[model samples]
Target: MSQTDSYDDTYTESQVIMTTVKIIAPFTLTYGMFMSLHGADTPGGSFQGGAIIGVTVLMLAFAFGIEPTRQWLKNSFVVGLVTGGVTIFIATGLATMALGGSFLEYDAFSETFGIAHYWGMEAIEVGGVALIVAGVVITLFFATAAGFTPERNRREDEPLEGVSDDD
Candidate 1:
C-alpha cells in the first residue's frame, strides 16, 4: 500500500463535542483576552492568556477535526501573528533605547513622551508576548498532529530506492 493509503484521514463527527466547543470557545477566547489585557495588574500574564487562546484553537480542532481546522486557519495568518508580535516586542525595546534609555525601559516612554509606563508594559503583554505564544502553540499543535511524511513530493507509483513492497 502507498503511504497515503496507509494513513487514516477520516473523521467521525461527535455532536456532543461540537456543541460543547461552540458553547465554550467564545468564553474561553474572552477570558484569554482578559488575561492578556489585565495581566499587568492581575495574576495572569501574556503567556497565560496566549496559552488560553491557543488552547481554544486546540479545542476547536478536537471538535471539528484537525484537517478542517487547519484549512480554516491558514499558515500565513499564524506566521503573521508571530512576526507581528516579534516586531512589536523588538520595536518597543528599540524605542526605549532610541529615547536614551536601556532596552525595554518603560520609564523612557514616560519620561520622554509623557506616556505611562503601564501602557508600555501592556503593549508588550498584549501585542508581543500574547501573539507569540498563541501562534507558537497553534503551530506546534498542527505540526504534531500532522505527523511526519517522507517522500511527500514523490508520486505514489515512485518507489524509494532499495525498498521493496515485498518487505
Candidate 2:
C-alpha cells in the first residue's frame, strides 16, 4: 500500500519468504532425493519423487524471483538435463533390446528387476524421470514466467545453425 512496501531492487518483502524457503527447501529437497532413491523399496516411484523435487525448484522460484532462478539455471543447461534424461530412458530400452529382450524388459537381465544392482531401474527412474521432471518443471517455470514468445520468434525468423535457409 505504501511506496516503501513496493518491490524494490532487493525485494525487501521477500525476506520472510526467502527465510521460510531457505529453512524448508533443504528438507523438501532431501526428502525428494530420498523418495527417488528409495522408491524401489517403497510405494512411490520416479513420478512422485520427481514431482517432489520439481516442487522444490518451484518453491525456490517463488522465494527468489524467476529472473534470478533463470539466470542461475541457464536454459541450455536445463535442456541438457532433459535431453540426458530422455537419453537414459532410450538407452535403457535399447540396452534391453541389445540383450535380446523387449523394450525395457528388465526381467531379461534377471528373474527380478534387481539384476546388476537394479541398474536398469535406477537409470530409468532416477536418471530418466527425476532429471527430466526437474529440468522440465524449472524450464517451464522460467519459460512461462519470462515469456517464450521471443524464443518462438527467433526460431521462426532464423534458420537453425548448420542448416541452409534455402531448405
Candidate 3:
C-alpha cells in the first residue's frame, strides 16, 4: 500500500475504536455519578465512583486506541478534578459561613438549608468523598499517562513487534 493508503487505513481502525469507546463511556460516567450522588446513603461512594470513571477512560484508550482515549482524557479529566473539588470546597465553606460556623462545619448550614444538622453533615461528607475520589482519579490518570514508558509506547504502536514466533 502507498503511504496515503496506510494513513487512510488508520481512519477505519480508529472508527472501530471510537465506536467501542462510545459504547462504554456513558455507562462509566453514569455509574460514577450514581456512586457520588448516593455516597452518603449507600455502601459505594465517591472514591469508588471516581476511580471507576477514570478507569473507563483508560480502558477506552487501551481497547480502542490511544488517540481517541487521549483526547477524552485530556479534554475533561482535569476539568472534572478541579471543578468537582473546588465546587465542593467552596460550597461547603460558603454554607458553613452562611450558617455562622467554622469552615466545612455543617451544623450552621443545617439551619440555613432548613435541614437537620445530620443531613448537612451528610452532604458535606458526600462532597468530601467526591472531591477525594476525583482528585485521586485525576492524579493517578495523569501519573499513568505521563509516565508511559517507551516499552508501553512500542507495545501500543507496533502491536505485533513484541510477539514471539514461537507462540
Candidate 4:
C-alpha cells in the first residue's frame, strides 16, 4: 500500500489540550501585549511580543485543529494586520520628515508638538512591528499546515500526470 493510502487526515480532538490552551491562552496574550507596549522601557520588544502572540494562535490550532483556527481568523484579518502595521511605520517616518526632521526622528514630535518621543517609539513598537510580525507568523503557519498541491483543481484521489503509483 502507498503511504497516502495508510495516512489519515482526520483531526482527533484532545480534551486535555483544549482545556490547557483555554486556561493559558489569555495569560499568554496579555503578556504579549504587555511586552510590546512596555518594551521601550524594558527588555522585551515588538518582535518577541509578536512571536508570543503568534504562538498563542498556534497553540489554539493545536488544541482545536488547524482548519477551525483558520476559519476563525479569516484571510482579510491577517492581511489587514500586516497592511496596517506597514502604514503605521511609514506614517510615523513621514510625519517626522514633514516636520523637517530625518526619517523616524521621534524627537520631531517632541519638538513640534511638545509630545514625548517615548510615545512615538511605543507606537512603532506596538502598532508597526508587533502587528506585522504576528500577522506574518500566523500566515506562514497556516500556509505550511495547508501543504502544497501542484494542481489546484485536481481531485485528491487523482495522481499527478508524471508520477506513477509504482514510483
RMSD of each: 3.3, 8.6, 9.5, 3.6
TM-score of each: 0.87, 0.74, 0.61, 0.88
Candidate with the larger lDDT of 1 and 3: 1
State candidate 2's TM-score.
0.74
- Per-residue lDDT tens digits for candidate 4, residues 1-167, read 55367557899999998999999999999999888887688998998999899889999999999999999999999999899999999999999999989999999999999999988888899999999999999999998998875677698898988799898
- lDDT of model 4, residue 126: 92
* lDDT (10s digit) by residue, model 3, range 1-167: 43235223242356766787788789888888788777667898766776776677676656665566566666465666656776776787787887789877777855677777666655555666665666566566656655654565675556454566687
Query: How far does residue 106 in candidate 4 sit from its true spot (Å)?
Result: 1.1
Please say which candidate is ahead in TM-score: 1 or 2. Answer: 1
Native-referenced Cα lDDT, model 3:
0.67
From the highest lDDT down, the ranking of the candidates is 1, 4, 2, 3
Clashing pairs in 1: none
Residue range 19-126, candidate 1, lDDT tens digits: 999999999999999998886898989999999999999999999999999999999999998999999999999999999999999999999989799888888999
Residue-wise lDDT of candidate 2 within 1-167, one digit each (tens)? 54347444443346889999999999999988888877576888777887888889889888887777778877788899789999999999988888778999876666544477377788798889888887887777776776544346675767655468676
Best by lDDT: 1
User: Which has the higher TM-score value, candidate number 1 or candidate number 4?
Assistant: 4
Better of 2 and 3 by TM-score: 2
* lDDT head-to-head 1 vs 2, winner: 1
TM-score of candidate 3 versus the correct structure, residues matched by position: 0.61
